[model samples]
Target chain A: MKQRLSTLMVAAVMTASFAAHAQQPAKKAPPPAKAAAPAKKEGITAEFEKFREVLEEDNPAELFEAKGEDIWKNKKGPGGATMAQCDLGLGAGVVKGAYVQMPRWFADVGQVMDAERRIVHCMVKYLGYKEEDIRKQPFSNDQRTPDHVSVITYVAAQSRNLKIAAPQKHAKEIEAYRIGKEIFAYRAGPYDFSCATCHGDDGKRIRTQDLPNLRKPAEAVKAYQGWPGYRMTGGFMLTQQWRMNDCFRQQRFPEPTYLSDSITALLAYMTVTANGQVYKGPGIKR
Target chain B: MADPMKIRAQMKGDTAEIRVLMSHAMETGQRKDNAGATVPAHFIQAITVDVGGKRVIQGQTSTSVSRNPVFGFKVKGAKVGDKVVIHWEDNKGDKRTDEAVIAA
Candidate 1:
């Protein structure tokens, strides 16, 4: 199965690159500027990496983590119950190392759920929040961030340095992974683009940002790690689900419903593929 | 109320390294919103750090700082277990104070 996927990906990359080259105007740029472009790009990328390293030492995500800890222990919501008893597949109140093992099957809900999805589910089931209300503004904007994103950040921080171990023991979990793989390769929409178009091969980049090859385990971890990240541009917390949603938007595809199964399936595929890699906790992103 | 800041204080050879992460919009009031209305300038105007009951840092900041700003300071003659308190007041008069104990 893996061999066939890689072979297909090579073909896709060939056509994609050909299309890119064919679209360029038959005009030559000044030779000097063209010669200096790659070197300048490398310099900027290295400097940006250094800046990120410094910022990571004092990540603003820590503030959200503190806030999330408060919400988990405090009594609020319509149910007036605390989320301290909520189970994250590791047992109720067991937060340590739970984030890395998520996108797992939950028998109670009879479905597979990612970290954000499960947290929202617990908020509804235990804390008595209306799913509709929570879904209304699931993402963060310039003004404010919804509570659940903070909660995910807090939870992810607890699993720092733990290996990714998203389980596939359950039949449904296996099913979700299969569906996720199909979804990744499935191409449709105005551009006829799939996730593979940008991320199926090594050395693919969108401008200065390098796209990780999710099909390979080493590169797959790059996709899984550093999520539920604190984006410095807008200074807002964002989750993997939001990243996936934004990708669809960039592709000009219809937006997936918040906490939808399709997103969970995709997460399962990515997380399981990234098994055994260490999660560096909530990250600071440019 | 604003979110609580995350403060870390660690002792490095008698100097306490204090790093604070404060949560604020730090709006410069220069940028227009989606509706084209100017965003009101709301940034931390004052910051003070106290270690072991002694004032160590009293600084002023402005709209130039980014949102969710981070600040680091090193205080000499600090010991382990010394209390490190960070206080900040924004242009809107909103204030927050958070403290941490110096770790070896």
Candidate 2:
């Protein structure tokens, strides 16, 4: 009888331990099949990564960077001087590391200018390159010559690997930053869209494309490097001017004048808000 | 605009990929009326594609082509590593030409 009781107790204990183990979910068990469906349906991140990989090779911006270098050095404007002599806020004649410091205030220029606007000033003053003409012919047939797009690429390329250091030293710089933040958040368009509409948050997309939150540092850096990119959709190589122009049109807003202060302000916002990020341009885009 | 337009092309196997980025506003003509007069008809008339030196695709397009238009397509037998050339012209005698390389 004693032996039988001991056997029974051992059996019961084993059963209880087994039951407890089953009750505690196994850590390595395949996740319930039902949970997989919802995860698969919300496949935003995976899609974005695939699309980005497609653009990894042979970015067309290399061409623009090459041309921009020529425009920077070659003397062509009415002034018959090379833009190499102009100041990009790294002091006169310094092109290195100037791009990442832009959207900052310049006491001499008396306004906050982004990379493109500053390039325009240099072209006009030092190179005698007329602003009107350059703006009108954003893309020149003379692929051999440096056009506005090429110059932008060149300047932006120079700042590659440099951190965004848009100076907040001047009062005007602060003012521009404030205005830029408002503009970014301000929504008024046919679609009631703002820059925030597409880029205000994380994990948003247009079709298979990823839309980065401009408010985030990593995302901003990833995007800021791609302006002045060659858009496969627009055959002509385009600069920031063309990019902003298209954005406004897509928003169904009236055309902003080329190189207008409003656009400049927007650029200021994009650059400064992208503080500590590097500038990479003439990137190839879809 | 000395040369009205130009196109160059190439082709590969099993795909007829082409790239066309044209220079035209592709104005929809439905835009506002100065004096309420409707804007006249203005649009791209045709686009031709050549792959590896053979005409593969020809399309008739309208003003709906975006400004500085661009297009991509795949066709039979166009292989990877082929060069695709495209040409486009408008009713107004404006034209443009561009090319791209094919990849699988």
Candidate 3:
């Protein structure tokens, strides 16, 4: 798989190099200084768009979504209940159109929650599973119990195509969004790294992937919707909570309790900031 | 498990460039050694990058990740000549850290 991807990468880069060379004027007439700036800007955008197109064909995230669906409908947990009955904030057992409205306030829960937390509630309340039981199992060993990996993939897939509409109607929901926005900008760690460190700007990439600016709508919506994806690096489906926890680990801050308020807040910010943008995740990622 | 992980970091423009070489088998638990016994899964559970003691990026990883996963990303506002440090911990509780100076 890796070899095929490398070959494709080389082919793409070579193609771009050839295309770029071809586009140059044969006479090499120097354009006006004013024209040069806009040309450069347009070229950069075009290049990035092309790069995104190349990656779209080979996203590895599909495999995880497939597996996640299997896990979701499969009966598990102490009660042997499938997740089909779990409510994702659209109503009990309602899977479709639930994700976009999430990070919203649910009076039943009395606190703001994101997709992951809501999944946990279904596992605990409806399925009669203990929270500790799920957390204690190692990622590798745990093959059951509404496993965070599979359920997240399943839930996120359900949200695919729905526009982000994280509601802020309730006071607590609004508070969560406020806290989430603050968390996104807060910088505290041994290295003083904040989410802004990598995501504050446009037109930057880590290695091959572009880092989306979280402060912006179009980019944030597109990027935020792509998680709960099957990460090529992790080799399994992951939810946003897992994504956020991993981000904290990389940030060198103590692990944010998985599915904690901090993560919920972050999701709130992302969902709200991403309002009206469609979700297309359970996506493949490198 | 006791081996020291080698870490190197550099400041490249507004981002802190980091590379970590950890001593781990990163066992996928899907592999069997020649002895036919399944190798238990072992991999880095977390990695963190700190610039001048501020948290930047944190990641949760697993055996599916590449061995000695060499991850790189930039932290905005990290200037040249700043100290960039990287630390990693595996499920086994093994820890390693390394630091490098940012270049102008």
**DockQ winner among the candidates?**
1
Best by lDDT: 1
User: Mind giving the per-residue lDDT tens digits that candidate 1 earns over B1-93?
Assistant: 777888888977756677777888888899899899998899889988787777777778887677888777767677899888889999888
Q: In candidate 1, residue B54 scores what lDDT?
A: 74
Name the better of 1 and 3 by TM-score.
1
Taken over the whole model, the C-alpha lDDT of each candidate is: 0.81, 0.63, 0.65
Cα shift from native, residue A165, model 3 (Å) = 0.9
In terms of docking quality, model 2 is incorrect
- Compute the lDDT of residue A244 as modeled in candidate 2: 71
RMSD of 2: 18.7
Judged by whole-model lDDT over C-alpha atoms, candidate 1 comes out at 0.81
lDDT (tens digit, per residue) of candidate 3 on A55-113:
34433344344455665677566766767767677777787778778887878768888
Candidate DockQ values, in order, are 0.18, 0.03, 0.02
Candidate 3, residue A281: Cα displacement in angstroms equals: 1.2
Q: Ignoring the other chain, what TM-score does chain B have in each prediction? A: 0.97, 0.66, 0.81
Clash counts for all predictions: 0, 18, 29
Global Cα RMSD, each model? 13.5, 18.7, 17.9
Candidate 3 chain A: worst-modelled 10 consecutive residues by lDDT = A5-14
Q: What docking grade applies to model 1?
A: incorrect
Tens-digit lDDT track of model 2 for A35-69: 67665634444433433343333344554565567
